[model samples]
Target: MAASTKNVSVGTVETRGIEPVPDSERHGHAGQMFWTWFAANISILGLPLGATLVAFRGLNIWQAALVAIVGSFGSFALVGALSLAGKKGGAPALTLSRAVFGQRGNAGPTLVTWLSRVGWETITTTTAAYALLALLGVAFDVRQNSFLTVLCLLVFIACTLLISGLGHATIMWINKWATVLFGVLNLIVMGFLVATVDWSKVLEAPAGPSSGVIAGIGFIAAGTGIGWANAGADYARYLPRTIPGRRLVTASAFGAGIPLVLLISLGSLLTAGDPSLATSSDPVSAINAMLPSWMAIPYLIAAFGGLLMSNHLSTYSAGLTMITLGLRVPRAWAVVIDIVLMFLGGIYFMLIADDFYGPFSTFLTLLAVPISAWIGVIAVDMLRGRDYDPDALMDTSRTSRYWYTGGFRLPAVLAWVAAIVSGLLFTTAGTGADDVWFSGPLADTWPGVNGLGWAVSIGVGAAVYAVFGGRGPITTPASSPALEESVR
Candidate 1:
């Protein structure tokens, strides 16, 4: 029989690795997804995203709100849809990818997904550390120093490791309770911030061009959900198969969407009054400056808590992805390795780097291409009714069913590569026109200029894969009683 949730209580390390959860062990309602995604997105990062809409994209309050709604909700709905794969296969997203791409072929997407997770976690850790530093400064008049910066990074990483190392049960539990506690705190802070908004300026701001709205939506979608598309299954894998898939999708969309819409709109409103929030190198301090002195402590605390919630989930998924990459270690140990890397990354971001958003924007743009391509492939695979073979997923040898053509699925790999190349042709990343990091040949095209490269990547990946990839007969898992018995 499969293990029970009772055996995996809070604070207990989840012993399961990348293998599919046996059906008997699967237990959870789709409603839990609401809290899971809600907690993941409750971070204050949405503010800057919204601010960028107004300050950079040149959208007014109403247009920015529309962009936030469509961007945040629509993208996460796709995440919810892809999560159905996890419910069916009961494995991590990348683990299930072994079925779509052969074992060796899966390595590329796995590596890219892992890098995206680590990159996001590092950003979360750095932001959370900044929140702590700001909190200390507000409460104790303490000043930032090299020692304190490193210490704060360690402290934030330690907190992340604690929950993520505990794995699924703890993450689910924390997601629910932490979301409630921090959600209320954030609302209170938002209430204060809202009071200070210059209504006159906000109301009078002219609407930006319709093109800005399109680009703003693309930017928000890429930043908010594209980064998370690969990890959807990591959390959903434990849910029972019988749960309504649409309910899971709705829960995830609304859970993430509601807060994001509010935060992003609020960001736009705030930026309409003071554009500095969009341009500030230190967003934490910039937002703090807007609040009254006493509210600073709770506001920063809420920020820290929110970032922690997001970091733990990212770290948890990164750990699973690491193991999927053939790391011969326990999941918890994998989390430790992830934390160490995040700590190093946080140190570099805080102490070494002079610019934050520039590198972060570049990271987001460059990685979104491959990740979206993976999403495109996986989404199409799901449509074809692909199912995972438990035994084959773990077998890396030539004898495995998924070891096609020397462990590569030509159509899927080719489509992914081709889509990435095509998408990059219209992609560009940098802080400003003078500091351009990379720009593709077709970057002058409307889609590239409008920041729709990630969108184009997904469409190209899906179109190419759909045309070339599904010709092979769908490989269903064997119905052997012995195989079923072994898994149980």
Candidate 2:
């Protein structure tokens, strides 16, 4: 990447490193986060999330709705708390994570975060590609074949990469309009479903046991919070430190939480009437099917915009995660690398992820575990008031305190590994509740214990890290000459 991309001040300060947002440079409001997260998360993505609870988890509409509302709170709490780190630390979330994970130790969790972004981007890419194919069928009467599918998939990637290639300010602008365009249009579709779907069936849908309900809520929470867990601070890092923590928290929590509740409610409603909700070709198309002929293309365009909006954020964060994981490249170059990696990874998933793909809900639930654990540990670190010096995290040299013992923090690493392993072994990483990928004794004893492992992982990881890791007294901010200079 050229030096030209940095310090332009078009959309941002635009420098690509973990320098602190000096008090003078901090100037944005917390309220902006409302649209930032709301627009980014509220989308067609929730369709499968809601449908999985109703169709696969055996939850009735009310039960699923209850879970959706409740679970999103927990998810966004994690999101908001981590997001608060940005205003306080003025560093990327993964950068702040170096405090807990140490320099090299953070790589473990960073890779997990990177995988989360790639998995999400790939899935959304596939979603948009399918919608493009459907639009072709609806408008141009084009044939659907393997070649067209691949071609459309490539087209979606090209567009996402091209725009994301322009960088952060552009992504923010795109997300702003994308949200406005999609929000009104999708709300109309939701209203149509609300007025049309038969309530009796939704009410009479069979409710499963407590275990399944727990899993359903866990799945939704993970889906709601996973993508943003490691990226919250990335956007907030540029915000003015004058913003109150409460404002930031409320803005992010509800910003993301509200849309999730709405969309998940819509998903549950759709599953109640549409028996094929889980098996639908594409969720937005399923919504368009409910609309009149004139509305299909317009609605499709709106929903596809959601994917573009999401991919922009994900790709941007993937770049930061790469940098956090020691990719010694400019932020712009890292983003380019992130795009290529996600593109190749999308193709790889299209080829083989389905061997294990039972429900999209399952895949998302598994992705959420390590992420939750990561945030949990970070939160505990914050509560303990240990040093989270931004400059230390950015420091490549050994002088930084975060570079603990060969750049690895032992207790934190152990805590992360223990939590993730515990989560995976007991949770249903495979299709069924009884289908533990690595069955634990507790899980084997209880067949319905699908996602207890993930919940446990969070508590266990936080507790262990709190005991072992948060021992140091908080240190004063390290003097950084770099922050005084224009990093751009």
* lDDT of the structure predicted as candidate 1: 0.90
Structural similarity to truth (TM-score) of each candidate: 0.96, 0.90
Cα lDDT tens digits, model 2, 9-105, are 4455355565556566665677777777877776688877888788778888878878888788667767777787776777788878887788888
Which pairs clash in the backbone of model 1?
A: none
- List candidate 1 segments past 4 Å from native: 1-7, 477-488
Q: Model 1: per-residue lDDT, tens digit, 153-270?
A: 9999899989999999999999999999999999999999999899999999998999999999999999998999998999999888778788889999999999999999999999
Flag regions of model 2 displaced more than 4 Å: 1-13, 206-208, 348-359, 432-438, 445-450, 477-488
Candidate 2, 100: how far from true, in Å? 1.7
Every candidate's CA RMSD: 3.1, 4.0
